[model samples]
Target: MNFKKKLSDILFLDIETIPQKEHWENLSSKEQELFTQKTLYQRKDEITAEDFYERAGIWAEFGKIICISVGFFTGLDENKMFRVKSFFGDDEHKILSDFKDLLESHFSKNQHVLCAHNGKEFDFPFIARRMIIHQIVLPKKLNLFGKKPWEVPHLDTLELWKFGDYKHYTSLKLLTHVLGVPSPKDDIDGSEVAKVYYQENNIERIVTYCEKDTIAVAQILLKMNNEKLLEDKNIIKV
Candidate 1:
């Protein structure tokens, strides 16, 4: 797919999530039992299900999005800008609400699309599940009730890199490095997100991490199209 035509039309995004409850004990006994069963295969006999609970954030039912960072292109070349914005905080409802507002207001057009590294598999469905849980109306972009595979208005950079090889998977950090894009990982990576949010109680750090990933995603897209990557001066944080 030629990304040049749609470069300015995509809302590049990334999200950071944490377990809904701070600790494993915070879950109801029934929830705990379900969690154990849900993770039984992965957890195995090596680790107790409760011990693996920190990773519950990977699942929508047990996780909540703490932050959603988005970036979009604007202006012409030489004056081009990739403006970044974030909807985040303690309240998941407000975050989802505000993000929905963004989709409806500015990115509601037919040409507009949502993007992320592995969004179609994780970010997109996770957002949709949480929105349903919170009773938020699904935005047109996230609502994929009956759309055909090719009809979905979404893009995954990871998929682009796969080149139709389903078994191949590459981390966003690795992709950036190989493509000569600046590394987004100055501090914590995704594995440390839960700790930073829970133990450190530092949401701001997570926001910065998410935003950097957002920028990195856009840069990767430009690289794919053989376009020049944006310089620091060209990135505007909103």
Candidate 2:
């Protein structure tokens, strides 16, 4: 399928999430019981729910977004550049509120679409759920109620790469490597995000990693469009 949308209208993004608390022991007795019941089927008889808590960041109900990095194209043709910005902090509500403001102020148009590696199944829904949890209003792009599937402005690089084959799953690192795009997982991967956030308390590193993933999503789109990748100098961090 041809990508007819203008690159300038696409907002490429990535998010970093960690479990709501540092450890299972941090949860209240009632909360722990609820989590255990929630994960009973998934964990089966192999491990206790507490033992599985480390993987909770993958679920919106048990996780909190710490960083959201976004990138957009500016200019046209050879003069185009990618500008990246990040909203991150220990306060999940503040991080999400800032992101919501950005969407409302700039990317709320019908033509504007948000892109991420696995956004549809992960990032997109995660953000919407967290926003609801925080009682923040869902941005136009993320509020899909009453809208047709086609009307929702969401683009997933992984979905684009699928080409109708739903059985295979591809990671952004592998996709970038195969497409000759720069790899963004040199220093850290998604699995390490929770540990880095909770154990190391390094929000800056997580922000940097999120920004790189955002840029990689944009690069994947350029590759799919047969456009040249942006040079390092063309990526501006804000």
Candidate 3:
């Protein structure tokens, strides 16, 4: 069963991350050894560790979050507007700290919950790990220290689609396409995020892409409840 929350109480979010350094050579000897050892089985025998380093961004320990975009609805029905804002830059610490403040200030309540696509496995844990690494305190919404699985204040669009099949996996792009939510991959996809950040050095483009995914998560939630999809005009980028 889909657990429904008031539209106004849910915060839809997405994050973009990149490898800590631009290239494999940028990592120290010890870090490279650690990376190779940990990823050996996952990379298989043919692909060298350096050749597989492009995937480092998917792991929080080897990567840093560059952007976090969030959207939430205000008002009801035809008057509803989704306000989106992004915290992004080359400074990972500042980005994490700023996101923590936003969570503590606006979304700090038992009634409030966070919703994201595949957030349970990826987005939520990645943010929490980066916050711990930076020595920033976790906000109520993100901190799962003593909370039971049922008590966690989070909603994952991917999890909802699973319907008790633990092995079922789906990408946000695929889910949105099948569920009739407007596709968020009009610009860049997740695989190209690292290249765009390191080679192209485009923070604005990343922020735009991240925000679109966040909006798509929101639209997916609405679709699950048989609500209308949001129009472009109703999506205000703050």
Please list the C-alpha lDDT of all candidates, in the order they appear: 0.93, 0.93, 0.92
TM-score for each of the candidates: 0.97, 0.97, 0.97
Query: Taking the tens digit of each residue's C-alpha lDDT, what string does model 2 give over 19-49?
Result: 9988999999998998888888999969999
Show how many residue pairs clash in every candidate, following the order shown: 0, 0, 0
Residue 43 shift from truth in candidate 1, angstroms: 2.0
In angstroms, the error of model 1 at 159 is 0.3
| Candidate 3 lDDT, 11-97, residue by residue in tens | 999999988988999999999999999899898778999999999998888999999999999999899999999999988999889
Error of 3 at 116 (Å): 0.9
- Per-residue alpha-carbon lDDT of candidate 1 for residues 1-238, written as tens digits (9 for 90 to 100): 4655567899999999988998999999999999999999998778999899989999999999999999999998788899999999999999999999999999999999998999989999999999999999899999999999988999999999999999999999999999999999989998899899989989999999999999999999999988889999999998
**RMSD in order of candidates:** 1.1, 1.1, 1.1
Cα distance off (Å), candidate 1, residue 111? 0.4
Better of 1 and 3 by lDDT: 1
Query: Candidate 1 at 205: error in angstroms?
Result: 0.7
**Where does candidate 1 stray beyond 4 Å?**
none
